[model samples]
Target: MEQFYTDERNVQILIALLKEHGIKKVVASPGSTNVTFVGSIQQDSFFEIYSSVDERSAAYIACGLAAESGESVALSCTGATASRNYYPALTEAFYRKLPILAITSTQDESKIGHMIPQIIDRTVQPLDTVKCSVHLQTVKDAADAWDCNVKANKAILELTHGGNGPVHVNLTTTYSRNFMVKELKRERKIERVMTYGKFPDIPKGKIAVYIGSHVRMSKSLAESIDLFCETHNAIVAVDPTANYTGRYRVPYMLVAQQSIEDENRNPDLLIHIGEMSDMAGIVGQPKSVWRVNEDGKIVDRFQTLRYVFEMPEHLFFEHYSKSLLSRQNTYYNSCMEKCNYFWNNIPELPFSHIWVAFRLHNLLPMGSVLHLGILSPLRSWGYFPIPSHIEVYCNQGGFGIDGNMSSLLGASLVHPEKLYFGVVGDLSFFYDMNVLGNRHVGENVRILLINNALAAEFHLFKQTNLTKVNEIERFLSAGGHFGCKSLDVVKHLVEDWGYEYLTASTKEDFEKVYERFITPDLTEKPMIFEVFTDVNDENEALRRMYFIESSTRYKVKNAVKNIIGEDRMEIIKKIIKR
Candidate 1:
C-alpha cells in the first residue's frame, strides 16, 4: 500500500505499520539521529506532522493530540539527552493511560559509554514512565529492523488499546538509515461489533445507571441514557464515578443519601457502565445488576457483584429503550418530590462545596476542558456539580500530581481553541512549576489555583509522635514539599512570562475575579487564577457540602481528628468557626 525509502527500510516499515494502525499524526523536534524517520514522514502525505523546536513541548503537544482523538500519536527525537527531553510527556502519557508512541533514534552501539556526545542510555532513560521500552539491537540487517518495527507497532497497539497507555521505542541512527524494507501492506479496516444478549423476560421496574471515572462515555450517550431514563420514569443514579452530572433536569443519584425512604424509588435493575463507582453505599439495594461494558470481558472486581456483560453500550441502549417495558411510568414524580424536598432543604452558603461548585461552574465558560489536579480540588470538583459541556481530564491513571501543569499545558498546546481550565491545589501546582518554563503555551489556557497553603489532603491523617506539628509546619518539613510563601513564583509566571494572571484572596475576590476570567471572547496567552484559602476552612467547607449527616459528616471530622487528633479538633473547630 503506502511506501517510503527502501534503503532505510526500518523507518519506512515502522511508518507503514503506524499508518496501518490508523495513526495519522506525528509531533517532532529537529534532531539529527531521527532525521531519516522525520524525513520519511515529512515527504509522506498520509500523516500530518507538527514540528515544535522544544522536544518537551513537542511531546506534550503530541500527547494533546492523542488525548483529543483517543488514538495513538507519535513523538520523535534524536538519541541521548535530546530524546530524554520527552520525560515529562512520557510520564504524563503513562499515568493518563494515553497512547503516545515515542521513538528515540540513538547513536550506534560502538559509540556507547565512551563519553560520546548525545549518547546516553536511551533505552533505560524512560523505563519507569513508559508502558513498553524496546531498544533495537541491530538495524544494519533487514530482519532486525523489520522485527523491531513489528514489535514496536504491536507494543503501541497494546499500550493504547483496552484503555491502557503509552509505549517507547528506541532505535539507532544506523538502523534508521541502513535498514531495508520488504514488501508490506498498510491497510486496516476496523469494524466495530455491537452485541446484545437477552435479559430475563420479566418486567424491569426502577432502573439505575452508575458511571465511573476515566471511562470514555460521551455526552450523546449520557444524554440518550438521560432521555431513556426520564421517559421510562426509571430511578436513575449517576455518581461522580460517572464523571457526568446535571445533564438531566432532575437530580439522579443521592450523593449523600439524604432522604429516600420510598419503596418505589429503589433500583430494580442497576445498569453500570465504565469504571467502578467511587461511592459504595447507595439509596436502595438493587434486585439485579447488569454491566454493559465495551471491553466485553466480565471482570468481577467485587466477588459478590452480579451482572451480565454486554457489548456496545449504544446498541444496548437503542434496543432497551424500545423494549416492551417502554410504556411503563412508575412513581417517578413522588421520587422526584422526595429528592426535591431534601435538595431544597440543602443550605446554600458561602465556602460550601455545592456553593463553590455552582460558583465555578457558572464562572467557567462552556466547552472548557477542566484539567483537575489530584487531591482536594479534584474531590471537591467531583462533588461539586458542573455544567454538561465541560470535559474533565485528570492524571488518574497513576494519580500523580508531579506533572499537572505540564500535562494540561501540553493539552492546551494542541487544542488552542478550547479553554484549558485547570483546578489545582497549591502544593500540586508548585510540584510541577518547572512546567512554566518558556515553552509553547497556547492562549485560552486558564489554571484555577485553589490555594489552601498546604497539603490539605493529608491533614486528616493521624499524627503520631513521629509527626506532631501544625499542617503548615509539617508540610514545610517534608522532604518533597513545594509550597511557596511569597507568591514570587506565581508573580514570575505572570509578570515575567506575560501570562494573564488573576489572584483572589477571599470569597469576594474569588467571585469578582472569576466574573471577568471566563469571557466568551477568545484571547491569546494562558491565564492563572490563584484563589487563596486556609486548609482547615476548606476542609470544614467541603464537609458540609453533602446535606445528609451520616458517615460523610464525620469523615471530615475524623480526618481532622486523625490529622490534629481529638484534642486539637476542638481548637481547629474554634479557629474555623471564628
Candidate 2:
C-alpha cells in the first residue's frame, strides 16, 4: 500500500497545524486508532520521529525531548488504557512549564456506553495534568473542520501561552481502511500576534469591523476606531449591546435583513471584537474573519478566521490608522445608505413587539438604563437606537427568558435615583414574578410586559415547517401559559402587591397609557405596563422585516407570497433560482 494521510479531517487538521506551529519532534507508540495520525506524520521528513513501544515511556520521552531542545514535542497513543500513562509526565510538564502536545486518539465515542471493545470516556482530566484539553469530534462539515482547526491551534498555542504547559488533544476517529490519499488539503492557519510582534498589513478590500457585546468604549478607544474607519474606508457593524456610539457605527440588524448577495452590504474582511453575541437572522458571508481580544484565545465565530490579534482592541485600531493621507469613506457610506432604506420608511404594523419598539425606541428618556429580555425584545429593539447616554443592558450572557426582570431590579439598586426600565415578555415576567413581592423594588423601577399569549420567537421563523404539523401551540410555542394574557390577571395581582398596574389591550389603550409608563419622573410606586397583542399580528410584524414596505421590489414579492401562498411561492423561488 502506498503511504498517505488519513481521510479523517480531525486528524488531518491536527497534523497540519503541528507543522504550521513549527513542531518537528514526536514520540509514537503502536496503536490501532492512532495509526492514522502516526502514519501520516511518519512519512513526512518534517517530523523527527522517536518510536517507543511502551505508551508509558512515550510521554516521558516527549517531556525530556521538549525540555532539552526547548521546543514542543508531540506524543501519540491510542485510547482506553493507553493515555492513562501520560498523567505523571503531563503533571511534571504542568509544573515545570514545558510545552508538550499530548494526542490521544480514540475510537468512536458513541460506542462507549454500548459496551463496545476499546471504548472509554476520557472527556475530563485532572487539573494538574495539563493546562487545557480540547476534544475534536468526527468532522462531517465545514463547521466541524473549522472547530477542529481552532481546537488544534489552541492546544498548540497553549504550549507557550501564559507559560509553557502540556495540552491534551482528545481526538475521535472513524476507522477507515482506505489510504490512497496523496496530500493533506491545505488547512486554515490562524496566527496570534503577541504585543511584541508587529501588526500585519491591512488587506485592501471592503472591511467590516464587527463590535459585539462590548463594554462601553472609552473616549480614546472610540477615537481609535473612528480614525481607523476614516483611514481604511471601514465601517463598524454594531450589535445593539456593542455601545460604540461613533460616527462610523452602523445599526446593522436591519441592514442584515437585506440579501446576502447585496455587494454593498457584504464585506470582504470582517474584523470581530468583544464577546459572544446574538448574530441570529443576520446575512452576508465574509471571505475571512479576524478576531481581536485581550485573552488571546482563538474564537472562530464565522469559521473563516485567518488571524487573531491578541491585544487590546484599541491598540489594533490605533496601529492600523497610521496614514499620512486621508482615505474616503465610500464603504462606510455605501453600507449606511443601504441601511437608511429601512430606517427612513416607517410602515404601519399591527400592535406587536416591533410596533411597540418603533413607538417607544426614541421616546425613552436620555441617561436612563434599559434592560431587555432575550429573543423577541432584543431583535425588535435592535432595529432602532438608544441614546449614547442611555446605557443598555440585558441577560445576553445567558440569553434566557428568566432573570430579565431580576436583572433590571438589581441594576436599579445601584442608582436608586435614576430611572431604570425593562421590557420583558409575559413568559419571562411570569417566571420571575416572585421578585415583584420584594419590598426593595423602588419607584425608579419601571417594567413593560408585552403579553401576546404566544411564544412569538419560537413560531415566527419556523412557520414553514411547524405550520405543516398539527397542535403546535401547546408544545411548539408553549402558548397560553400564565393567565393567557387576561387583562385583570396581572393588573389585579400587581395592584395588590403595591405596584401601579397599567394595561393596554389596543393601540388606543396603549396611546392612553404609554406616556405615564415612560415618564422620567419617579412615581410614588413601582409601575407595570402590560400590553397585549395577537399571535398572528406578532408574526406578521416580524415577517415585515424581510419586506421593506417602500420598496417596489419587495412589495411585489410580498404580494406574490400572499396570493400564491408562502409554500407555493417558496417552490417558485427555488425553480427561479435553478
Candidate 3:
C-alpha cells in the first residue's frame, strides 16, 4: 500500500482543523503547490473531494455545494493567476453571504520579488474579496506549529461567525516530496472558555438572562437556571417562544413598553442562551453580554460579547450558581413591577388577532403545546403569560411564514395525547393547507387562522419600512394572493378534508364559538377557527396597546386632556405626542 500523507506540519494542522470543524467537502483544482494538501486529504476517509481542472469553475462548484448542503465547502488551487481566477466566484459568494473556504497554495514570501514561478502576493486588498484572510507559514518548531494552528482555526471559524461569508487561507509550501508519514499527529484543540477549569465569578450588578427561541427545557436545567437567577438577583427575560416557565420569567414586552428614562432596567451583564430570537430589538441592550452555547462560536448579537462559555447551559449555571452569595433582589423586583403594571392595565382589545389570543389565553389547556406563526401571531402572544405546563414553540429560526402549519401538524403527530394549538395568519395557513389532507393528522390539533386578507406585517410601523411607501399593498404586502375577503373556498376545502370549520367575524360570534373550539372534549376532529379582522383594526389595536404602555408624562397629559373639551385639547395632544 502506498503511504499517502504529508509530513509538512502546517499543512497537516490545516487539514486537522478543517476536519475538527466538520468541513468535509473539498473542490480541488489542478495545482502543484497544493500537491501535499490535495494528496493528503484525498487519502483520508473524513473528506469528500471533487476534482475540477478550472479554478474559476471549481469556485462556483464550491458555492453550489455549500448552498445546497448548508455546510462549508473548501476550494483549493495553485498560486498566482490560479488564485486570481477565484475572484469572480468569491465576490458572488461574498454578496450572497455563502460560506466558501478558498485555500491557495504558494511558494515562500521571500521569492515574491524574485523571478520565481507561481509566486504572488495573496494579501493585497483581502477584505474586498473575502470576509477575512490568514497566512499559514511553514512550521519549523513547536512555536511555529502553534501559530499555524491558531491562524488555521481562526480562518475556518470566520466562515460562519457574525454572519456567514467566504474566507481565504494562503498556505506556503516548500514543494517537498515528503509523503512518508502514515498517520497524522494529534493536534492541539483550542477551546475558548470564559471560566476555564473553574467556576465563574458572578458579577455584582444588574444581570439579565435573555432566553431566545428554544425548545422546552428539562426540569433540572430549568431549576438550575431558576436558582442561578435567584441567587444572583438576576431577571430571566423571555419572549413567548422561550418556553421558560420558571419563577424568574419576565416577558420582554414589559421592558420594550417602558420609557428610556428607566435606565435602571438596563443590565450590566446580559447572559444569552438558546437560538435566534424575534425579540432582539424589543429586549433592552446590555452593557456587556456573555453567551453560553455548546457550539462555542462567538456570536455578537448584542454587539457587546465579552465572554463565551462553551459548555452545556445547565452545567455552567449549576456550577456558577454554587459560587454566588445571596444578594438583594433589586433587578428582579424592578422588572416584575413593570410587568405587573402592564398586566393590570391591559386595555380591552377589539376583535383582532391579539384580542383573540388574549381571550384564549386562560382557556388553553394545561400540559398542552402552542405553536405561533412568525411575525404577527408571535408578537401578539408575547405580551401575555402562558400556563407553566403549556410548552411554546415557533418557527423563528427561519422566521418565515412557509412551514408554520406543517410544523405544527408534525408536532401533533409525535405527541398525539397532548393538545397542540397553532395560531397563524391567513397566508401561512393557506400556504401549508395541503398538510391537512395527510392521513397522519389527529384530533389533538387545533388551528386558529387570523385572515386579515393581506400581509399585515407590512403595515406595522415598528416592523417594516414599507409603511411610508405608496401601493405597498399591491407589491410588498402580497395582496390578493389567496383571494379577497372570502373564506368560502377555505371552508369547503377544510370540510372536505374531514376538519370541523368554524368562522368568527365579530366579537359576539367569537365569544359564542371560541369556547367550543378550545374545549378538548367538544372537538371530535381537527378544527380550524377562522377569525376575520381588517388591517385598520389590527393596526389600531397595536397602537392602543403601545399607548397603554406609554410614558407617565404622556399618560398624564392624555388623562388631563380627556377630562377637558376635545377641540381645545387637540393641539396640546399633538404637541404631547411629538
lDDT of all predictions? 0.63, 0.84, 0.83
Clashing pairs in 1: 9-179, 211-241, 211-242, 212-241, 443-525, 460-559, 461-562, 462-562
lDDT of 2 by residue, 1-578 (tens): 68888888888888888888899999999888888888888888899999998877888999899989999998999878899988989998899998988999998777778888888888889999999999999999987887888888888888888889999999887877556677878777888887778777888788888888888679899888889888888888877778787888787787677543366555788888878678622425777888899888788777778888888998888888888348679987877777787888757788998899999988888778888788888888998866667777778887778888888999899899999999998888899999998989999999999998877666675468776667777888788888787878998999999999888888898999899988888899999999898888888887777666557766687777779998998798899999
Taking all chains together, the TM-score of candidate 3 against the true structure is 0.66
> What's the CA error at residue 461 for candidate 2, in Å?
5.0
- Residue 232 error for model 1, in Å? 5.0
Which predicted model would earn the best TM-score?
2
| Candidates sorted by lDDT, best first | 2, 3, 1
Among all windows of 10 consecutive residues in model 2, the one with the lowest summed lDDT is 258-267
User: What's model 2's overall lDDT?
Assistant: 0.84
lDDT of 1 by residue, 1-578 (tens): 54445455456567677776677789988877888788777766787889899999988998899888877788888876777678898898888888888888876767778998777765465455787676654556756754665465455555645566778887656634433344344422122223533444324577666554545466677666766665566654544435554334233444434432345434666666666444434435665556667774433332223444447676666656664345444555655655555444445454533355557764577777777776565566654445656677777657777888888888787767777877777777777776766467777677777665566655533324423455445545332344344555576666577688888766777777777678866676667777766655655554455445434444566666778887787787699998
- Candidate 3 clashes between residue pairs 3 or more apart in a chain or in different chains: none
Regions more than 4 Å wrong, model 1: 1-198, 201-205, 214-220, 223-232, 239-266, 276-287, 301-303, 308-310, 324-355, 460-480, 546-578
In candidate 2, stretches whose alpha carbon ends up further than 4 angstroms from where it belongs are: 113-115, 259-261, 280-283, 550-578
TM-score of 1: 0.53
Q: Root-mean-square deviation of each candidate, in angstroms?
A: 18.9, 4.8, 14.9
lDDT comparison, 1 vs 2, better candidate: 2
